[model samples]
Target: MSEAPFNLVYLGIGTVAWGVAGLKIRAWRRDPSPGLLVVALTIAAPATAFLVAAPVLYRLIDRVAHRGNLATLLVYLGITGFSAAAVVLARMWTPPKERGDAQVWDGATADTWHEVRRRLAVFAVLVPVMTVLFFTGGATAPETPLTFDTTFATVPQIALFLVLYQALFGFALVDISRVCFGHASRLPTGPLRSGIRLIVLGGLIACGYVLCKLIAIGAAFAEVTGTEWLSTALGPGFAALGAVLITAGFAGPAASAWARRRRDYQALRPLWDLVYRADRRLALEAPPSAWTERLAFRDLEWRTARRGLEIRDGQLTLRPWADPEVVTAAALVARRAGLDDEDRAALIVAAALRGAAAALNEGTAPRPREDQVPLPGLDAGPADERAHLVRVARYLYAPLTGEALTAAATTTG
Candidate 1:
């Protein structure tokens, strides 16, 4: 194949890669809501079709230029019109479900729309200006042989599209990375962490490409000739590099998913061991008196809550809420931190004692239910209650258990 055809192939491949990414994203979504699915299909289907047709269009351009430049212009205009319509229609026809039920715009979709709006405004203004310039410049006749000028006219359009495409894809990658990294804290050392790191690196590399492209565009505008070989070379090189980087970006997540499935049985062994050690230490150090304080285990509960655990039916139910293993591991850490056998025994005994005292007090006095207590009297504004709980819990369960327990007992009494 000629260089033209070879370049077309690269373009085709790049387009297909983007299409595949869209489909993959939709497929991988835990819940591919109908609206999102429509959005994905609308974007990806047209993009894929464009790629498949691009080579034929390129060949037609070459042939039609020999016959007449107007034919080439018509073709270009038609493609542009069709592409614009496709984009607008996709946005309009998106299902209500995919349109997002969010009362407030907040996540990845919101960011994508904001970018889309910005890019649309830019194109709306610039395309008209460019069209006028193309007709009036007299610098190059419409009839002038299609050389780099034809390519040049399309440059801004291509650059704009590339910018929007990168922004959307980059945002998706970042969101995914954030999720993966957030899970990393709970996960054992594994491919999940590696995947998140790869995505971060890939995003940085992609950003560099975007920066290079912007610099090239600025150079093109500043140069007297309106085009520089260096600028042109740099722009395409950055775009191609960005394409490769995006492809590499998927590697981490894909690998992580595969690894997690394959090693489910033994993957968390190290994490469990660490938990076990921490639990042992805490159990040995915590004193009986410390366990009497209501806040003694508050920190642990707070941490558990952050990790998606909950107290249900007044039982320490640890399963089906968050990752049970993670909660178990945390419990072990609390035990090893200094909570001792005496502390555990005291917790049981204190619960009974408190219940008895509460019963006797209720018989003697008109005790109000917790809910019946006036909410107006309580400071309900946002505060770091969890932090306070954690501090108290740590003090009650740590090496200073003896002192903490005595203070806690006195305060409670």
Candidate 2:
């Protein structure tokens, strides 16, 4: 295999890891919690590992250190740190059992953290031990960046070092996969569940990398030949692919949430603008401008939520002007057009709101009606309400909606 692909894969994984880590850092700044910081560091650890493992950088690093394989020790340390961080993340992510006993819950949480700390302490001890073994094993002088494991597998010290490192790394991979699978099974289907599944899969593949290296080392110790390919090709390949999957796993849920927020923010614009024109006071914050508001991504969740509330406020304000007959007319038109129940309802609401806004703008005296056009999602939660509003906005300017509003206005006028 060409080193180009390996280098590219490693660099790509590193880039993704840093991106995820940056997001976590941003979140940590908002919440400033320890667990959030740990999550960021957890991702950064493997990111550093892969960057160091890139063939060109690997050789460059070792050469710079004036040690033949110093990059190997650095890479191992990064992986060990990642292993410990993964364990921490797994513990932190698992929800506390729903026991009513507060003390029991506290004790359980404490015990879990204690176990996590104990395991991490063990990894800490192993890091220095592995470094000692690497130097003492006489495996550091040959500059075998890509083939270090297989090349020195026959050396007793090097073999022992490899075994101990792989043991710790493999244990972490298996433990995390098991825990994540259990937690993921209980989660409803969504980006979070999907992300956890990807992590589990990545951990399993990383386990393969550890297993392959250990087997190759064992084969070499037994004076077996022709197994170098396992450590050099298959093992590294598994490690690279696993790293990519794990990075994606961390990024998937975050990216999904960001996309949803952006979509909702953009989708609600037309309805927001219409209501804002009717009553400028509907907007609590003087958004810099319409163009800047569209371009703004900072505090997006807050802005989207504020926009939703403003829309709801506008709907309530304009309800007195709404012609209930518009709702009836639009419903009939939508039914005749064979629109689905959801779209039909949305079109009806859109027509009512549009006519109401027009009435308010036209200086038509607001008259109290016994029956008002009911707004969609009045009793729904914020998310469901926003979703329905987005649908209503989509049909706000539709021909059927316009026709219904015209028919109602003509009759009412």
- Highest TM-score against the true fold, candidate: 2
What tens digits encode model 1's per-residue C-alpha lDDT throughout 1-413?
23464356455654765655564564549555434443344334334433433445545554655532333333334333323433332333322234353211123366556655664575466446545543443332333222323233344543343344334433433443354344435434655345435544544554554455445445544443444443344433543454454344444454454443333212222222222232333222332242243233223323333321111111111111122222233334446655564343333222222232333434534234431222110122224322222232333233343433344345456
Residue 290, model 2: lDDT of 68
On the 0 to 100 scale, the lDDT of residue 322 in model 2 is 83
Query: If scored against the real structure, what TM-score would every candidate get?
Result: 0.35, 0.85
TM-score of 1: 0.35
Candidate 2, residues 9-75, lDDT tens digits: the string is: 7878887788899998898898676677877887898898888888889999977888788888888
Show where candidate 2 strays beyond 4 Å: 95-108, 284-299, 328-348, 368-376, 410-413
Displacement of residue 13 (Cα, Å) in model 2 is 2.1
For each of the candidates, the C-alpha root-mean-square deviation to the true structure, in angstroms, is 15.9, 4.1
**lDDT of residue 271 for candidate 2:** 90
